[model samples]
Target chain A: MGTWLALVASLNGLAAGAFLLGAFGLLATRQMLGCVRFFRLQSLALVASIFLIAIGMRVPDLIAVALLDLAIKPLLIPWLLRRYVREELFRRREIDQLLNIPTSLVIGLTLTLTAYFLAGVLPPAAGAMGNINVPIGLAGLLLGAYTLAVRREAVPQLIGIFAIENGSLFAGIAIAPRLPLVAEMAFPFDMLIIALVIGILTRITHERVGTTRVGALATLREGAPK
Target chain B: MTLFVILALPLIAAIVSALPLGRKLAPSATLLAAVASVCLVGRAALTVAAGHRVVAVPDWVELDGLGALILLLVAVVGTTAALFSWGYIAREENSRHLRQYYANYNLFVFSMLAVPMLVEPALVWTAVELTTIFAIYLVAFDNTPEAVEAAWKYSILTIMGGAMALLGFIVLFHAMRFGNEPFTWAGLVKLAPKVSPEVLESAFLLILIGFGAKVGLVPLHTWLPDAHSQAPSPICALLSGVKTTVVLYVILRFVPILNASGRINVDRWAIIVGLISVGIAAFLILQVTDYKRLFAFSTVEHMGIILVAAGLGGAAAHYGAVYQILNHSLTKSFCFFAAGTTLLAVDTRQIADLRGLIRTSPIAGVALLFGGIAIAGAPPLAVFLSEFSIFRSGIAGQHYIAIGLLAIFIIVAFFGILHHLNSMVFGEPMPQATPMTPVHLPLSSVLTLILAGAPIVILGLYMPSFLHRILQTAAQGLAG
Candidate 1:
């Protein structure tokens, strides 16, 4: 029992470490592919955490959840991102981010601290698994939202959005390990479909207007100007 | 059984209608599928009215009075939209786009129906997200520059909201763990009192804002007008009429659980956001130039009113809100179909270019005039009756300030819509525009306009015993 508890704690620690690393990497990376690769790692860590929790809690059904995450998140999403990049922005690999890497990293760290502070403020619920997981998960969530706001490219924005999902999944696993297996299964499928739809929309935008910057999509308004 | 049929039939129709054989007979196939679903809805409504709830697959799918009310709305509007699509889309696109359009349209209806039917909270959120994905494709069906852009904006903004809502779901699911209850609506509501107050409060706020964004609440509604104006007219009718109501229903589903929390007054947040949306959209309506956009902003305003009604926190307010849902769905859809026919007749959506509409297309012009009046909450129309109930509930609940503010904004919106619509219907015809051949209105579209309008007039003046009973039950159910 002691060994199992230690193992669970260390596994959750590893998951939080991976999530924070990916979030900081999101701030540090200029290449769209690199950001997506970080998301893949974050999702992989989340899957590992889910497996650890399943093992610790003796709930075998979560194996399916881990497998679904592995199939959709680390494998399928990254593959789709690669294809989207090839199709939409053939020559461009780097995103011209709104904030420079060093400054954004500083802000990302501050967000992590803010997340810790915010999580500290919440009165702890009884059934939560570990103290560190919620705060770390929140850190990932905040960094992910910040990345979405700061990134200008479409693919990076998609990555940021996926990062938010990863954070929530991590928090959800730690806080509610007994969440219905069906609900857990549905999350990955929804994210997969959303990624595919975003890919299709990006492809269309690229082919028609030769740009995938969200800032460029400001033409529609109240009236057609004379 | 009936619940599953109401949910699954449209999805199956969407898939089957995507096939080559089905594409060739898309309109008839879609109409048949829609009619079949309406039959199922009628059956389910009967079940609910008999004081029996349908629980399909245990906790995953269920329908009670509130669900039944929304199901009936989706069925009626969906059938009309399908019929309107036949006449409105047939002449506008090629066979390939037509097939894709019908498929997406049906799938869109399926997702909306799934929201009100699903009992599991997570699955309900999934269905709501599915609605946006399916609808965004339909929004961009035209492949025009404006259409693509609008679809993209609609996708990103609403998905962002969906993601936040998912976060709330995660928190709520975590809270449910405290009592070892299932993560369904009934389970969560049953467990609400045991959950930590702090967690419940945060979850409620996150959810209200998250789904609130999709409901086109102010400051998150930049996508509403763009998507509405750029999409084909039939699709716009569904987006404004059925889609918004369905999302709001999802929001309302959480009301019982939030009420049970015993730690927070969630209605205040609803009232605040409701007031802002109504006030902002009402003022913004005066500045819109596109006729379709004008209708779209009116949707935003009406959504605000419904939210205010929901926020008022009384049995009567809940009743009024559900009744308003039905009224807005019928009247707004008729207005969009009328706008589509008007666009078809005149070949433009610009308000400035659509002068003397009565001279050009008398039926469509008259439809627009009356539909506009119905939407503006004029007397002896469906919206008027519902809005009156909302006001009475607000006064009774002592939400005097909110009611007063809502009254002012609603009147402003009323004149704003009436001014634009009246000019288009009654002003002199555009002198510079060339006289064109009179376009014949499709039989399906005429039926849609007449069918949608009939309920608005009839239900306003008289309510059947069964409907009144259902509304009362739904309102009571919503309150607890």
Candidate 2:
């Protein structure tokens, strides 16, 4: 029993660490490909966390959810994104982020602190699960918001969004174990649809402007085009 | 019987419209389905007026006084739009695109109908999200790059807002788990007293911002003008008028819970956000150049006004909000329909390019003029009645500053609308070197104009006893 508990704890710790690392790397990394790769790693860590939780809780439905996450997040989404990147032949080494890396990193650290502070504020409802997982989820939320605020490239912004979803899923598993399985299943389907739509939009963007950068397409404005 | 008809009729019509045979029958079929849905909604409204809650699918779908009021607005406008589409699409000339247009239109109506019927919070979230996805196709139907980009931005912003709402739902589910019963309105109400105040407060805030984005409150309202300006005129009517109201209904669903929990103060926050949105959108309305975009910003302004009334939380204020919703749905959709006719005649959405509408098409010109007056809250229009009630309630509630600012913004916006109406409806017709192909107005368009215009005229002069009772019940529901 001790061994199993230790294993589960260790895996969760590793997953949480990987999530934080990926979030920081997403902010720190200048290259678009590097951010994508970091997101893939973050998704892998998410899969591992869910798998560990399912084994610890002896919940079979969660295992199915874990499998779905593995199949879609780590495999299908990355593959689709790879095709988009290659076809577009993006050569830009660094995206002109809204905020510099240093500033984003500082903001990320503050967000992590806020998450930790918030976790302390949550009253114990789902045992130690809430205590441990809520902060991680908060971190994920902040990271997603930060990515959305800073990133110029459409693809990286999408990754940031998925990362936020990953965090919310983690929080859901910890806080609401009895959440209807149907709702859990709906999450991946929604994500898949969002990914497909984003992919199509990216393709269209590439076709229209010869680049996937969103900032260039500001010609259609209110009153008149700038 | 009524609930099932309301849900299934439009869905079946949408499916049939996608078929080859249904192409020739598309307009009439949609009109028939819409009329059927409206009749059912009217029956539901009557039932609610008689002091009975209509539980459609029991735990999964139900209609209360509030839902019934929104349903009536949706049904009335939907029927009108359907009638208008019949004549409007025939003028398209391009057969394939016309078919696609009707198909999307039917699906859009189906989604809007589903929103009020959905009872479960999670189901409501999904329904609202479906409305966004369905409307995206409509917004981008023109296939113009600008239209497509607007659709994409709209989809992304709304979906992201939906994600936040999903998180809010998760929190709500967690809070509700303290109760013994399943997830339903009754269950939530029963559990409200026992649930943690902190959880309820946080969940309410999340839902507010999440769905508030969809309601096109300022800051998050960036997509409203873009999507409204880009989508076809009929769709603009639905998007700005019915669809936003449906999402606002979802947000309003949480009010009773928040009030019951006694931990969160909903009215104060709603007032702050409402005033800010109304004030910002009113100014932005003044600066806008595109006529469609002007109406689009006006939507944001009106939504802000309704929210402000709702936030005031008195019997009169709540009733005013409900009345404003119905009036805005009628007036805004009428304006859009007129805008569509004018666009078809003049071939431009730019306020400067659209002049001499009266000389070109007097029917459209009169429609635009009257529609503009109605939206601007002219006397003898339902909007004027509702806005007056709201102002009276605001002052009664000791919100003197809010009332003063609201009046100022409304006056400014009225002038802005007048500037465009003057240019578009009264100027001499711009001469075309080549004789232009005359586009005929649809019977549906005429029906839409009448249906949209009727409520404004009738409700302004006198409020029916049944509708007055229904609004009172709905107001009480919000107040609780």
How much lDDT does each candidate structure score? Answer: 0.83, 0.78
Provide per-model DockQ scores.
0.61, 0.40
Docking class of 2: acceptable
Best of the candidates, lDDT: 1
Stretches > 4 Å off in candidate 1: A84-96, A121-129, A223-226, B22-24, B178-182
lDDT of 1 by residue, A39-128 (tens): 878888888878877777666888899999999999998887667655436345665678888889889889988988888544442333
**Over the stretch B1-480, how does candidate 2's per-residue lDDT look in tens digits?**
578778888888887777777357777678888888888888888898788878766777888777788888888878877776766667677777777777778877887887877667767777787787677778876767777677767876777677667767777777766778667655676788889887777667777887888889888999888889888888888898899999988877777787778777888877888888888888887778788888998999998898888888777888888888888998999889988877766677777766678877777888889889889898988899999999998899898887898899898888888887897788666676112765566666777787777877898899888888878777776765
lDDT per residue (tens digit) for residues B234-318 in model 1? 8998899989889888888777888888777878877898899999999999989888899899999989898889889978899
Two-chain complex of model 1, DockQ on C-alpha atoms against the true structure: 0.61
